[model samples]
Target: MPGTERSLTMRFLAEPKDVNFGGKVHGGAAMKWIDLAAYGCAAAWSGKYCITAYVGGMRFVQPVLVGNMVEVEAKVIYTGRTSMHLGIEVRAGDPTSSEKHLTTHCVAIMVAVDDKGKPVPVPEWVPVTENDIFMRDSAIRLMRMREKITEEMSAHLS
Candidate 1:
């Protein structure tokens, strides 16, 4: 996604420590990758430190095995007055076969804050490509879903 407010790519080699008893990478480890990738995107977009405010629609489609190289790609999908949403894709690279497989995907919402931890407005974002448009649209859909879920939960509680 070109002209995105920010983007980041990180790679890690899967190891035994990252795996669970089943020899597959633990869900928590994958989540950690997501968090770091998203945080980096937000910080790059804001040009300052950003804090994660929420996470949504984290789905693990497949398990990554040890000895595979994993790559996480993150990009800013949208920005609000004080927040931004990052879309992340986790891909697994097979060392022996040299094949890459998308294993998981997620969206992370982050808030821009001042030194005192007060929310701050985000700067203008630029979207110059089709990939950027797709990412933005996905973020919009996720935001609407979040709103709908919140409303439903509120109604249920009431």
Candidate 2:
């Protein structure tokens, strides 16, 4: 069921297939999980098809090993007319244990789309709780930083 309309969480086992030669989960696999979780949250909130517009501010905090329980959570921290800014977190823990630690975190921006792939409006997200307020503010801050980085990258092409 729907615990939260603006958030989605997925849990799975980190399998050997997901591991790299270093015996840790591959970075690409982790990124794919993040994108999937963010997409789920965006689609649930918008009730429409969504496409990933951007993913950034990624931090790999720790190694996620095979046999670990992996949890990927995505929350809609902010919403624009057609875009949703998601705060995604990946956690890992031994299934035998109750504690989980953060392994990865990032921000993903998803745009809702119509059947023809045109952008469509997303439901507005309003911060109510303290954590919600903080996350929304953080999303805005990340957006500002992203704008600066884009501008700098574009200047090199001129």
Candidate 3:
């Protein structure tokens, strides 16, 4: 099943407070924005409250400077039972030039939960466009990667 595209964008004014001593935005701050964006996408797709079950493949492609406006976008790529896969991208925009550059990409898996905090099934999703196919495939790949990572982690723990 395919899910819809739910996106959110925000212009981040990198104030001095958001910068490190080196004048670059902190990775933690960027991750916080990523989470927020992904959560919004997942909740919108689920049409209910959802909790993050996993996060995957977060890579920083570029550094956001102190004055760059960071935009985070998240979309639903796949859904299964109670889980929804969200693809999130963070971009840095130069307000002076009106140029945007991709800075980070991440995948988040969220599970819809009931009032008792137990997992609940999500409604059927339909993807009727090429973009939807791309998202669905990306989600499948991310889910496979997550399974492999979990297995490796469990092996180490054991």
Per-model C-alpha lDDT, please? Answer: 0.84, 0.91, 0.79
- What is the per-residue lDDT of model 1 for residues 106-150, given as tens digits with 9 covering 90 to 100? 889988888999998787565669988887887888788889899
Task: Please give each candidate's TM-score.
Answer: 0.87, 0.94, 0.87
Kindly report which residue stretches of model 3 are placed more than 4 angstroms away from their true locations once superposed: 1-5
> Across residues 1-158, which tens digit of lDDT does each residue of candidate 3 receive?
22443655666676777777777888888888888887777777777778988877899999998888778888777788898887888898787877789999888888888889999888656566999988898788767777888888997783
Best by lDDT: 2
* lDDT, candidate 2, 14-106, per-residue tens: 998998988899999999999999989988898888999999989999999999999999988999899999999999999999799999999
**On lDDT, who's better, 1 or 3?**
1
Among residues 3 or more apart in sequence or in different chains, the pairs in candidate 1 whose N, CA or C atoms overlap within 3 Å are none
Report the Cα lDDT for residue 10, model 3.
Answer: 60
Put the candidates in lDDT order, highest first: 2, 1, 3
lDDT of 2: 0.91
Better of 1 and 2 by lDDT: 2
In model 2, the Cα lDDT at residue 138 comes to 89
Q: Pairing residues by index, what is the TM-score of model 1? A: 0.87
User: Candidate 3: lDDT of 82?
Assistant: 92
